[model samples]
Target chain A: MSSATLEIVEPGLLTTVQDAGRYGYQRFGVPVSGAIDVFALKAANILAGNAQDAAGLEMTVVGPRVRFLADTWIALTGADLGPLLDDRPIPMWESVAVPAGAILSFDGARDGVFGYLAVTGGIDVPVVMGSRSTYVKGAIGGHLGRALMASDSLPTMERDGHPDPTNNRLPDHLGAPRYGNTHEIRVVLGPQDAAFTAEAVQTLLGSEYSVSIQSDRMGYRLEGPVIQHRSGPDLISDGTPLGAVQVPGDGQPIILLSDRGTTGGYAKIATVISSDIGTLGQAMPVDTIRFATVSVEEAHAILREREQVLRDIEKAVRGAAAEAVSIRIDGDAFEAVDDSGRLVSAPAVEGRVESEATRHARVTVDGRTFEFDVEVQRAD
Target chain B: MREDLRFLPAGDQAVVVELGDTIDPQTNRRVHGLMDAIEREEVPGVFDLVPTYRSILVYYDPMLTSLPELQARVSELYRDLEDHAVATPRTVEIPTLYGGEYGPDLEFVAEHAGLTPQEVIDIHSGTDYLVYMMGFSPGFPYLGGLSERLATPRLDTPRLEIPAGSVGIAESQTGVYPVASPGGWRLVGRSPVRMFDAEAEPPSRLAAGDYVRFVPIASETEYLKLQESAVKGIHAGDAAQ
Candidate 1:
């Protein structure tokens, strides 16, 4: 049986359909709701043979219990959420097949904070304002504009002929993921760096900040040394970037995230570099983090190196053995059965339903076409 | 006295051009003007440009253009700032239902202003407003102009949730909540207009430099009907003036 749907048995701590992010909408105050650790999201998507920005599940802390109704390839990355298929421990950072009716479950995280699960063909949801990312605050985008609820079923896109993505793994040279209790987050000095006294800047650099319980997707509140300001920690409201360390009057630093407000009035003494934002995102409450300053050139070099690493992973995955069991159809081609058959639904393509006959079904499997007899049951 | 423009590095990818240290009409307008010039010239590698009260943040792809090159290019553009003509802002009149349930803190605002709710309505609606920028919530305008008399501080303890379209004042600024969310602004009215719609083209009803006029409405039933239409994209009384 070719399963094309994922039924949610448990929604985990907080699971949302996220992609690269909702871009170009920040001008109107739309938060860019993407994966906390985009590196993991990209890796998972690459392993699943989907576009790098394809919508995937971003699970926080714990992972979800999912049962597939179709054969699909999947890759898990980021935090080590102990995922098991049919009670068997599976490998992370590799594309693997999930047969129809296979139960995938996970216990609490063994390593990281946010785990990304990318399925072959990606999670198909209506693209709202140019993204599938879930910004729960505005009740916009992703699955029903909120976190995944129990018993909710997510749809996967249909794919055409291709080598099964299960023929992929994170090459050894790419290096294993790092999930440590403490992180040294690199930052670039700010647009309002002058607002803080030299002593405050030193205090920030010299002190260790722990992630506070008040942290969320919007911002990470760090509790530590009081970052004394020149006057007050207030600036005319201005556009805030991801990882901006906005210091309010309380002097505690708040590292803004992907879901941060478009503009902020608090003065940000410094901004965390893009590459370290993922590392910062994985810092759970009570996790220790210390600030380190890096030149912009160094930051760019780090980002470029990370990109090269992903490229190498993709190149290596191309040569691995196939381990996937899911059936996939091309976007241009799809499995067609009687409307009354067991497969209750699929992504609708208008005027694609050719006939009214309920006796036959045609499906494409592993690049070839096959037909099956169907017995339709009409509603009373 | 006007201050010279200063460029500040946000990160490797973004640079902020500070028009001034304070939020004034001319400084804010200059910020928006630079945004227009950047957009018109199609600054290479720029993926997003955000115009704020006194600064414009240009987020670019550093791989395509370096910060120094972009800054030099922007500096050249700023040299022509005095010659550039400002675009005429589009005016959208927001129909506000002041006092009573729509504004939970109406009395507080009136008492602070030393006026009746009716006078507060007159003063609030009488002046046209400038949208400093969009932030806080989707399509929520950070308006610059507010009547000094009507200025009220935020509630000592903010409500857990403020309904969408609740027009509030904080210090010398006034704005509406585009979506139902937790906020700390002092509410004095509610606008029936939907400030944001995910399905609409250009989601935010108001953009930076846009003009807003708060027109008062009486009936709650009428307000609800207009809100439904606003959600569907027809703002009952709004048109570019």
Candidate 2:
């Protein structure tokens, strides 16, 4: 089996390989580094016929310009970075097949802060501590434990025949997270909320907070209403979960993310719900965020709902692969015949099949019917 | 079960089991004790257990276990925590080179503490400090048991980058920076020990509930030799105990 290589032409602003996350080591002060917008990364992986946790390139603000060394399928998701294939605009959140030497580039972020690009077999980086996610602070995991640079070559794992790329996309209306300048982020009042004044809690939930300029992958420092603490902003340092809204002595809340320190000393008044963290991942500096309260049960329900959306996307991609049969004879359209020699209308099938086939072929009929013999005959 | 133990929700996936309010040895022991019990029980869906000063944050998957269920399980584990002994804490000796270039802020800290540089060094290295928790950065221990005589205020203006292994003091706290980062702590010495190695098993050299002792060396030559050995992948903590 031949492995493909992805060569970087330009490193853009910041791009690194990430996956689900590095876990089970937070106890030792290791941050669970992964793609910030997990939903987008998972969706990109699903569209590219890879596992949800497959390592992929996570681009921030701007995206890297890369050239594929071999023919492969890829999907772009998350922030709209104006991705282009060989100088032509390509669709986002959908799988696209690229021939060998095809160049993929981006024109900076148009909608959000982070974007994800997932390929067929995922980025073939050595898994460090059971994950390929990059923890830049520790200088561990991913491609050399750092962001991608120009002239760097990334290996791609070898896989069996590719999944049918057509119709493998997440529709925008189907619970896909939306990115904008202002977002309403939901939070659950935290383990340290009692340390803050009641007015501070109201201040967090009532006012708008803008992402500070000092924000990075570690966390977003927000500037907004001062969340006054009852006594002081210090606490017996405790474990900081992902999306922990910790306020320092200055009373400014910092929403910790994937690369956050495992433990922190500030009093965290609330924690952003897991379902809404992806939205924070897409927020740019100065982007305003209004906080809303949610019960833990409600947060779990939201997470389940988001998970169900992913499941639906996976089902749709698989269903499309099973139901559609793209039959192309020298780029000419041909009518497909069923097992009983009946002309069956194929609505799901799209794109040209790059194969020479004249013999027997099995295809799904009406989404429920079993294998039907598809006779690929010339229209002439 | 301790009457002060409070189970607080940290988002939807984690619970902060507060054993007590203060950062004392007894409270920290309970934190680790409960963590050990929970780990031994192998409760389903529990992924990571972080023992801090007086709390253990239990990270779990909401899909496999709900907050109430996890809280209940942890409560049960806490009830029986006193029956099981917490693991014996290890004392990792960190060899240090104090004063001069290795410790740029030594004179300042000495002046702040109203003691000579040697006296500050002697007091700082004399005690076996308890590793209360690891935080801020990887393998960076939050040590307790600092001598009040050696206590000094943090630098009013934090240095942009404090080199890794720089031993520093601030107010009532004293610890070493495991990595190069901007910090306000007043540096008194530098260690030749590598506190964190990402590629090594149990990456952090020190863990919560452990003890750390600073052994001061006389010369820069000795410091360089130890630093070279550390670079060669020799585990300093392994041999120094």
Highest-DockQ candidate: 1
The total of clashing pairs for model 2 equals 0
Least accurate stretch of 10 residues (summed lDDT) in model 2 chain B? B232-241
Misplaced by over 4 Å in model 2 are A1-4, A160-167, A171-177, A320-380, B107-118, B234-241
- Residue B13, model 2: lDDT of 84
- Please give the TM-score that candidate 1 achieves against the real structure: 0.86
User: In candidate 1, residue A197 scores what lDDT?
Assistant: 94
Docking class of 2: medium
- What is candidate 2's CA lDDT for residue A82? 89
- Candidate 2 pairs with clashing backbones: none
Judged by whole-model lDDT over C-alpha atoms, candidate 1 comes out at: 0.81
Q: Which candidate is the best by TM-score?
A: 1
Stretches of candidate 1 above 4 Å error? Answer: A1-4, A319-380, B1-3, B82-84, B103-108, B182-186, B218-225, B234-241
**Each candidate's lDDT (Cα)?**
0.81, 0.83
